[model samples]
Target: MTSFQFTKMHGLGNNYIYVNQMKEQLPEEELSEIAIRVSSVYTGIGSDGMILICPHCCTCEDAHFQQ
Candidate 1:
């Protein structure tokens, strides 16, 4: 079993889950499963959805950042 941590936020009654990619590393192939697991109200954190925030290392506006 593995444990994950997230920051929670809400606006106008809508919930949000913030996952800091800069400090936390999650396997890209399993993001969908992780998202579903975290969104579960019974077995998980119970949020509307997950937002993966990444760090910007390049100046290209259209550049994709990955680790």
Candidate 2:
């Protein structure tokens, strides 16, 4: 199992788990599971959802620059 790092934050009351995919490499298939795992209120990061913060890229094919 591959593990990544994340941070929890709120904006004007709404909370979300932030994942910086720019620095941490993760498999594409695992993104959905990561979001679910991180947003769990019982045994996880405990957030409303996940907000993946990735780098900006000109290529739409880039994982971080999903269209």
Candidate 3:
């Protein structure tokens, strides 16, 4: 079985499963399926949804940075 680490967090009674993509990655094509599976209360980690914390992509030219 394939497994990745995750953290569960909540605020104001809302909760979600957070996956740090900076440390690991899931296949882009399977993200929707993964979210559904992980969000199931009876079969999975049980959350309102899944959140992927990814590294910042600096490749976007339109992005502006302020000091």
Candidate 4:
């Protein structure tokens, strides 16, 4: 098994699952599947969603994009 830094934060009795990958190696293509599994209310560990704190922010990190 591999170890990584994770911080599970909760508010208003609602909990969130965090998977910090700043210093870890994970396949990006498998995130959605993992999220769905983790957040599933049945047949899996229940949670609101997963929070990913990474080092890079695609192209929006330049702070010059319009939504």
Candidate 5:
């Protein structure tokens, strides 16, 4: 089994699972599947959704560009 670290955060009753993409890499194709599993109350971590914490640098090709 694959193992990674995550953090759970909530605000005004809404909650989400956070994964640090800068520290760990996840398969891009499986992102949707992973989200569904982790968001399941009976089979997984149970959250409204998953959030990926990406690095903010030009070197990171997948990183979002900010002005």
Candidate 6:
């Protein structure tokens, strides 16, 4: 079986699933279905939404300048 590493978090009382994109590649076509399936209250993992964790490509200097 295939496995994907993820994290789970919640805001207020609403729960969500977080996927680290640096490690998992979810195809564009599967995005909508992935969200729907994961968020389904009755059929799937049951979340209010899914959150993606991705790296920030810019340098620290750029971040400081943007601030």
For TM-score, the strongest prediction is 3
Indicate the TM-score of model 6: 0.67
Report residue 45 deviation for candidate 4 (angstroms). Answer: 1.9
Residues forming the 10-long window of minimal summed lDDT in candidate 4: 58-67
Model 4 accuracy (lDDT, Cα): 0.67
lDDT of 2 at 58: 77
lDDT string, candidate 1, 1-67, tens digits: 2466779898998887888889777887887788888778987878888888878878786544332
Each prediction's whole-model lDDT (CA): 0.78, 0.73, 0.80, 0.67, 0.80, 0.69
Residue 56, candidate 6: Cα error in Å is: 3.1
TM-score-better candidate, 2 vs 5:
5
In model 2, residue pairs whose N, Cα or C atoms come closer than 3 Å (at least 3 residues apart or on different chains), thus clashing, are none
Off by over 4 Å in 1: 62-67
Model 2 scores a TM of 0.69
Model 5 C-alpha lDDT versus the unseen true structure: 0.80
Candidates in order: C-alpha RMSD to true structure? 4.0, 3.9, 6.3, 5.0, 4.7, 6.1
Q: What is the Cα-based lDDT of residue 15 in candidate 4?
A: 76
Q: Each model's TM-score?
A: 0.75, 0.69, 0.77, 0.64, 0.76, 0.67
**Candidate 2 structure lDDT:** 0.73
Poorly placed runs, candidate 4 (over 4 Å): 1-5, 57-67
The residue-by-residue lDDT of candidate 3 on 1-67, one tens digit each, is: 2488999999999998988999679987888888888888887878998888777788774533211
Model 5 residue runs over 4 Å out of place are: 57-67
Ranking by lDDT: 3, 5, 1, 2, 6, 4
How far does residue 22 in candidate 5 sit from its true spot (Å)?
0.5
What is the per-residue lDDT of model 4 for residues 1-67, given as tens digits with 9 covering 90 to 100? 2334556678998877778777885577776677777668784468887777667868664432211
Model 6 per-residue lDDT tens digits across residues 1-67: 2246667788789898888887567775776777777778876679877776666777664321110
Model 2 weakest 10-residue run by lDDT: 58-67
